[model samples]
Target: MPELIAPEAHRHAAWLQAHREWGPGAHEDGFGLLHDDEVDSPDGFAAWVARLRSSSGPDRCTYRWIIEGEQVLGGIALRHSYSELVREAGHIGYGIRPSARRRGVATWALGRMLDEARAAGLARVLIVCAAENAASARTIECQGGVLEEIRATEFGPARRYWIDLDTR
Candidate 1:
């Protein structure tokens, strides 16, 4: 079974394997990876992990990795508060390694993150995915996500959804 874990330096090798699978880019959403984040070196990776660990405040994000045994499968993140950025990116962001897609990894991670959101006192959460991402839409819908609208973002057109926690 896959389990959610905090980002840690000890998992660097496994994490790198998964990262490489995603190819080169800042597109690994749930890891909280920034364009400038230096995750290729031990020191830089540790620093990045530390930054993720320190983001416990209400306005920050909490990140978790999906791991089954020693293999890192994917990541999920829950933003603790709403912001202009959240309006576009949503309160949660996630990505499953290509090898792990279609395995219910994202749905499981989203459900876990929803519990985290509820514990943090959010009554609802906004989740937006690429307008053409049908798999993500189905996953969100399975969790009771109601579509709001499709809007153009800096990245592209995205399907916005709101999941009411009270109904979950």
Candidate 2:
């Protein structure tokens, strides 16, 4: 495997554009983002770039993963800290390009993110996925996530899971 890296968000624009994925009503590429499409539009893309450059406080780290050289395989984001909103939705969310799904990218990317979270002083973390998304659930489980509950949310039905980095 190539090195797991953190590229400046500005340096990720073309990769982001080329790797976007649309999954059902949700764009898989947009999985962890609050407003993914906005970042893909003209003015929106510019604004997104500016946000990335100036991101601070709990927003300091965002990474674009590359494989075998320059191929932008996928990415992972680390919130320095999570608010109530994130505790319920999961601290990290990721998407492999459609072409990269099922080849263990998410598992690897997520495991890496968990390590980062642990290094940042998190002893345990919550990771939620849509209830119907078996693949996501499996990935979480594979990483030692304990299923805590399955419930309805404003965002629809979701499964709440927690992983203890201390044990992993």
Candidate 3:
């Protein structure tokens, strides 16, 4: 079974490999915000994770690896709270490994992330995705997400959905 594990130094190689799969800049699609130029080694990546964990910023969140054993299939970030940016961005963000795409990894990871959200006392959670992302829209719907609105943001047109943990 795939589980979400806390970010650790040892998984750096797999994480880097996934980043390289997406090429440069593309990995910024929710794959660790740490710049590749700054993280030359696993230790450096660990330091970066530590910094994010310690920050008092809007991006502050607990990022975890979506793993089945040692392989890093992807990652999911569960934010502690919603900031102005997070309200727009979301309480959670996820990225799937190139090799693991289209096989239900994202859907499963999201289901698990909702468990985390509920545990954090969030009665309902907001999730947003690009309007053009059909797969993401499907995933959110499968998880009982209700369409809230289509809003324009700096990122582009986005679909915002709300999932009620208490009801479903």
* Number of the top-ranking candidate, with TM-score as the measure: 1
| lDDT scores in order | 0.93, 0.68, 0.78
Task: Judging by TM-score, tell me the better candidate of 1 and 2.
Answer: 1
- Candidate 2 off by > 4 Å: 9-13, 16-20, 23-47, 58-68
Q: What's the best-to-worst order under TM-score? A: 1, 3, 2
- Write the candidate numbers in order of decreasing lDDT: 1, 3, 2
Predictions: Cα RMSD each: 0.9, 3.3, 2.2
lDDT tens digits by residue: candidate 3, 114-150: 9988987888888888899889899889999999999
Mind giving the per-residue lDDT tens digits that candidate 2 earns over 39-143? 555566556656654557754555435453656666666655677656666776666776667888788888888888898888888888999989989999999
Q: List model 1 lDDT by residue over 1-168, tens digit each.
A: 999999989999999999999999988979999999999999999999999999966569999999999999999999888888798899999999999999999999999999999998999999999999999999898888999999998888999999999889
- Give residue 63's lDDT in candidate 2 (0 to 100): 48
Q: Which structure is stronger by lDDT: 1 or 3?
A: 1
TM-score of each: 0.97, 0.77, 0.89
Quote the positional error of residue 43 for candidate 2 in Å: 8.0
